[model samples]
Target: MKDTTIDDISLISIPKIKEVRGNLGVIEGDVIPFEIKRVYYLYDVPSDAQRGGHAHKELYQFLIPLSGSFDIKLHDGINKKTIHLNKPDKGLLLVPGIWREMDNFSSGAVCLVLASQKFNEADYIRDFKTFKSFKR
Candidate 1:
């Protein structure tokens, strides 16, 4: 596995169409680097609850806060970063080999995740100690 640093993380601007009555958000074309193969979302999470405590070996992910806000803590075995996401038109691009933890969600916050790969158990590094010792 490649040792992707926290500096590799980027915020992508999802396209938006402003209208008099309402606005529309689009995520097609090359907005996301990977071809989305799986889509999932987290909703109705408690404010004190936490999620995502693992790293992917070879998967790309784009995270968007569809409603409310939350904080994502990323680690790359050597570096760390904290990103607060709250906008609908903004998305965070996470490459492979980074440890991510999501928490501090506002009430009724919905986190939408677009994945480049399907669910694969072998592609995940669930333990932090193993993540630090296994991959480089």
Candidate 2:
């Protein structure tokens, strides 16, 4: 098996109002390019927290740090990449067949995730050794 990485992270920013009684804007079909099927958030986690120790066979995910910062370790079977997510406007788009681990969360960090598919336990590859053998 090999260390894996995929290029799917993309930065997204939406204009927000800074004052009371101020108008906000929404660009139709511009921000959030994906059709979201589910919305979730990971919060109230301590420092050195670790999540997502599996690979999806047929699901897509977009991860964003809502409050603080964290590190995303991504693998795709042949390469590995670590991304530092600090800003709220930036998100990582994780495609299928990529293993990801979310760790090194700062205090009061809130992670927002959008999914393209529903939850399926069979779609997860949990064993790292099995993932090693799953490469092309």
Q: Highest lDDT, which number?
A: 1
Q: What is the per-residue lDDT of model 1 for residues 17-110, given as tens digits with 9 covering 90 to 100?
A: 9999888999999999899999999999999999999999999999999999999999999888899999999999999999999999999899
58-92, model 2: which lDDT tens digit per residue?
Answer: 77777778789989887877778888988675677
Clash count for each candidate, listed in order shown: 0, 9
TM-score of candidate 1 relative to the true fold: 0.97
Clashing residue pairs, candidate 2?
Answer: 3-78, 3-79, 4-75, 4-76, 4-77, 4-79, 4-80, 5-76, 5-79
Candidate 1: what lDDT? 0.94
Segments in model 2 whose C-alpha atoms lie over 4 Å from true places = 1-5, 12-33
Worst 10 residues of 1 by lDDT: 1-10
